[model samples]
Target: MKTGLPFRRPRPLWFVALLTTFVLVLPAPAQTGQLAPGVRGLATRAPKNMKIDGDLAEFKDAFCTPVEYFSFDAKTLRNRAVQFFYLWDDEAFYAGLRTLDEAPANFADDNHLWEGDAVEWYFDTRQDENFRSQAWPTNANPGAVHCYWTGLKGTNIQGRFCLRPGYLNAIPKIMIEVGARRTRRGMEVEFKLPWANFPDFKPKLNEVIALDAELCYSDGGPRIFRTFAYGSPLSVQQPANLGKIQLVEKLAPSLWKACGPVITPVRCDTAWTQNSRPQITGYMAIPPNHAEQIGVIWRNGHVTGDLRSGVPARRRAVAERPGRARHVSFVRHCL
Candidate 1:
């Protein structure tokens, strides 16, 4: 089943203006590459009249990714399931999480919020280069984002960086719009992350990124357990290990014909890197169904590549050989 629909082109912020106006140093968007399974999901465009009130009403019809993996201490938490939602608009990336919990509370403030009942989210705006990275966060060329959101702040919704105290001070302030609603059954957390924070990234059609949402449960004493939608031990090692999701137009149930991924890399022919054999890659997006039946195709300055454990490792031919596309690894924020 296929349908034709018209979509609007994303408006660019011309982030280049920052380079000339403020002489700000922005980390270049990680070089991307094509990998089929690497993309765990697709985020359809938000409705024109969308609201971020933390209610699940707007997402009533959207498909949800479940958070099934839990920590050893939380093995009995099978009853406490979680559902994650994703949406993208021209200006930002939006995420939502809903879970069953008798006690949803977060007493910790600022950097210590992880100790309370909260959702510690991680995002990899960079494509294959840092998609499922296992490295620690760095200021020089930061590729992943780590943060915590909790609405139990009592006063209002709050979010904070989970990075080292001053690790992200140098970067521009990231304004995230977050909200949460407590229900008789559980709670819902939602947030909108603007592309402006990622000055180098201009959200285009089918632009993909890696992300995940981890649900932390405290129930008063302390964060007793945790669960992951796209589980990766992201505490400090895995940022790129988050799940892969791309921006798309109207998400239809059955669409055989659709737009392909748009993989764009920061042009850098010569790089002065600390590691050897560093590779340049391009990324492309495909419909979930066709991902398994991928056919060779080429785009400008990009080649279809492969992913091992979410990291793009080696290169493939321009248009030859039929093989399975390796899946990418899979996080979220809130208040």
Candidate 2:
């Protein structure tokens, strides 16, 4: 069922101005990860007011997983600006993505999304113990699930595929929520994967799930090349190379504040690069009140710097979970 809600505009003028200034003057937000790629990291619980508007605000405090450092051709750096942020609640896994694509074109209705510019994901539920031993072109592996999103002419489409036995029988009706919007720089997509979709696997705290993310690129043809958060030339056929994600309890609001804007550790584009250019997208209230606390509302780029800061931080408890699939593969496909 759908409900109509008023469209909320950007934060107020004075407030946004203050945020932009802080973002500029403040040092880049500190993020923790091994200096290398494919490192395992933590995924936090979803924020209080999560929305699927294809904007980055709802991803605040979520685990910020970098999709950089992917290798292409085993010799060149697959340097495309893309980041994957995720969270979890009792029922589903949530993902928010921003990709830097200089030229976004390709609105195919077929699996050809992999051939054109798109975002795609691969997953191995690890629900079956023999999943680790499975290999190659012949194995559609009942354990694998693929999902992707692409856009053309203002229209957006998302699709899902599974390798489990009978196509319809093995795949449960996944409750998927997607929102794709073209940004000034490239493109951004947000989605949620309900736990019910993974009938064999139930998410429990502190458990590991095998996962990988790819930013597939094509000017308007078959997939020419791609980048990955994990998985290399043969890794797609070899699931062991995929990284792992550990489900954690929802983080505190204060932790989100500490992370700063969604586009932390700025890149070159000056327009919020997920595909190209990086620039301050917009402003968000810090800590305590978040964006809602801001008093004035301004359009995207009109705010100037007169701001206030008196919001206090609130604390909450960590939820509980104790199970994880032994060798699940998780992949995220996008545009």
Candidate 3:
């Protein structure tokens, strides 16, 4: 049965202003990843609030393990299983989730079903900065970017999928249902999402993408089966800690040869390079005023080798001038 409720918008004005500032400060052509062809990994640009309808064979690694790093303690509900799947057509990227349980899947008492289970989707449209800003600096707030959640019973649903930065806050247009018969399978839920809702973005064929997903469940008495890419505490009021989700990397058509450096290049200026000390070097550079400037570059033995395998060597450069010493220290501080 379909419950026809008017769409609800739940974002506050201050949140909008914060988002606007974030978008304005975002750098141009934000770095993004490539989505791989076929159906093994995440899509290039996943739909905002879509319920995917497909097989769950390929996504075993993503959904099988119970996330121990970020889990909540409530009444323990046993035998809960989750599966994830992703696909892409010419127009949109699709994501599908399936949750299996052995219990009756009750939602009637105090709307317990609505409270027990939730699925969350995080989009990294810009890919580079990971949709973060100095103001918010974190993904705890729903207003930070496009985010959505839906309960198992399909009540208490929230969504945001509009083009005007903050305007993405809107209700989902998908359907959620529970099994009518109580079989050995327990309970199962399926979800589908569309691509149009994701704005100002495009994906190259077979471009790997990065995204995050969370599955939460309650046993009607207490929270159970709570898992997330990142960790969250038991308090529902607290925002989910999203930093834990390991970034999903996608391989491009170019393969390793085309893949850029895994580690970004270091920016070192206002320092000098001196051969006098092999272990402790100097990075020399002319100041904007064209005056002679010199700074020391110190390297720790532990930090050596390719950027991917070992940590980069630490370097510190100090200028002889009075005020310039502080500038060199600031640069070294980053090390």
Best by lDDT: 1
Q: State the displacement of the C-alpha of residue 239, model 2, in Å, after optimal TM-score superposition.
A: 2.4
- What's the lDDT of the predicted structure labeled candidate 2? 0.48
Candidate 3, residue 209: Cα displacement in angstroms equals: 4.6
TM-score of 2: 0.54
Candidate 2 minimal-lDDT segment of 10 residues: 312-321
**Tens-digit per-residue lDDT, 78-190, candidate 3:** 33434434445445444444444444333423322224454555544344453332222232222333333333332322221222133244323324221122223333333
lDDT of 2 by residue, 28-65 (tens): 44222221222254567777666776776666556654
Estimate, for each residue in 129-188, the C-alpha lDDT of model 1 and write its tens digit. 655667645674365577666666733444333443545642354667677887655677
Better of 2 and 3 by lDDT: 2
Our tally of clashes for model 2 stands at 42
Query: Each model's TM-score, in the order given?
Result: 0.58, 0.54, 0.38
User: Model 2 misses residue 128 by how many Å?
Assistant: 4.9
**Better candidate by TM-score, 1 or 3:** 1
Question: In model 2, where do residues sit more than 4 Å from their true spots?
Answer: 1-39, 68-79, 136-143, 151-170, 219-222, 250-335
